[model samples]
Target: MALVFKSLRCPHCQQPIDKPLLKQHGLLQAFLKRKPFPCPHCQEQAVLPEKYETLISIGILTAVILAPLLLVWEVSFVDSKLLFGLGAALAIAGLITQKLDKA
Candidate 1:
């Protein structure tokens, strides 16, 4: 199983945010519920686009699939890094597809 990532964007300013940033701000609730998440760039509230919801589901699936592999498989460090990188790339791609919406 491969790792997958989910990306987030600020709808107001259209700025991309990584997982760490979102976690720091406790914005996952907004994303999960399609509620408004504040945009640091524009100081406005924004919500995740409907189209990008699948990305979040995919990210969860990937995590479920890859977590056990990481624990039980004899994967090398480089392989693990590459897997994680792929996950990050998926997340970034999902984020890039996001569009801003005024809430």
Candidate 2:
């Protein structure tokens, strides 16, 4: 069986904590069960980060990369409308992924 260590300690206070997890079981417990993890040393509490909630950073980064590429293609071509399609697609994707990330 694989060992699973779930908690950590505050460096200064030596308080045990629910250290960051990629997909924490902390979510179900904190919200559903009403058992928010408390620090052993201090009253400080926390929640899973927004960036850690889902995998959207990659999509945003991809949009960033493709945005420039589309712009370059548009600049290099005679038919600028081709660039328009590409830019519109990238912008839509970026807006969508950004909303997803916020949620």
Best by lDDT: 1
- In candidate 1, stretches whose alpha carbon ends up further than 4 angstroms from where it belongs are 1-6, 54-96
Q: Please, what is the whole-model Cα lDDT of each candidate in the order they appear?
A: 0.60, 0.39
Each candidate structure's TM-score, on Cα atoms with residue i matched to residue i, is 0.44, 0.24
lDDT of 1 by residue, 35-88 (tens): 777776666887655655466456544545674477468766636545655666
lDDT per residue for candidate 2 within 1-103, as digits (tens), equals 1111344343445544443431253443552232343333453443333332123444444445554665676655444455445555654554343211001
**Root mean square deviation (Cα) for candidate 2:** 11.2
Q: Which residue pairs come into collision in candidate 1?
A: 5-91, 11-100
Model 1 CA RMSD to the hidden true structure, in angstroms: 8.3
